[model samples]
Target: MTDEHDWAPDACTLPTAERPLRLAEFDRLFRDAVRDTDRPSPRRLRLRLDDAAEPVVRDLIARESACCSFFTFDLIRPEGDALTLDIRVPPAQVDVLDALARRAAPAPRP
Candidate 1:
C-alpha cells in the first residue's frame, strides 16, 4: 500500500510522524467493520458496518480525529443491526478518501 501521507499536501491535517501506522490501523479496523460502502456524494463516502462493530469503529474514529482534523465523521445508527460512518473531506481531497476506501476493501478470495 502507498503511504498516503506522502502524497497528501504538506499542510495535511494529520500528524505526519505516525501516518503509516495509522493508515495500517485504519485498514484493519475497516476490514473488520465494513459491511457496505459507497460514495454518497462527490466529497463524501458512507461506510455501513455491522452494529456490533461500533466500539472498534468509534475508537478508530476517535484516534483518527486527533491527527486528521479535516475529516468529518458522523456515526449513524438506525433501527437495525447496522451503523453508518459518514466520512467527508474537502472536494479536492476526495481522492485521499478514495485511497483509504481502497485500502479498506477486503482481500479477494484466492
Candidate 2:
C-alpha cells in the first residue's frame, strides 16, 4: 500500500498523525469489500461493493466527508442486494480521485 501522505491532499483537515490510520481504513474497504470499480468521469469514481458492506461503507464515507469536504459521496441500492458508491470531486481534485481509483483497483490474479 502507498504511504498515507502520498494521496492525501493539503486540503484534508485530518491531522497528520491520523492520516495513516485513515488510509488503512480505506485500504481495508477496498481490499475486502470492493467487488468492482468504474470511472465515469475524471472527477468521479464508482465502486461496486457487496451488500454486506453497506454499514461500513456508510460509516467510512461519513468520516471521510468530515475531513474531506471536497468529496461528494452517494450510496445507491440497485436491484437485489447490490450496492454502489459514487464519489465525486471538483476538477481541481481530479488527481486525488485518480489516486483513489488506483487504490480501489483489484489486484491482478497470479
Best-performing candidate as measured by TM-score: 2
Estimate the lDDT of model 2. 0.90
Candidate 1 per-residue lDDT over residues 11-82, each given as its tens digit = 466666777677677777777878778886878888888788888888888977766667899999877547
lDDT of each: 0.75, 0.90
On a 0 to 100 scale, what is the lDDT of residue 91 in model 2? 90
Candidate 2: C-alpha RMSD to true structure equals 2.3
C-alpha TM-scores of all predictions: 0.79, 0.92
CA displacement after TM-score superposition, residue 20 of candidate 1 (Å)? 1.8
Clash totals for all models, in order?
0, 0
**Local error of candidate 2 at 68, Å?**
0.3
- TM-score result, candidate 1: 0.79
Worst 10 residues of 1 by lDDT: 1-10
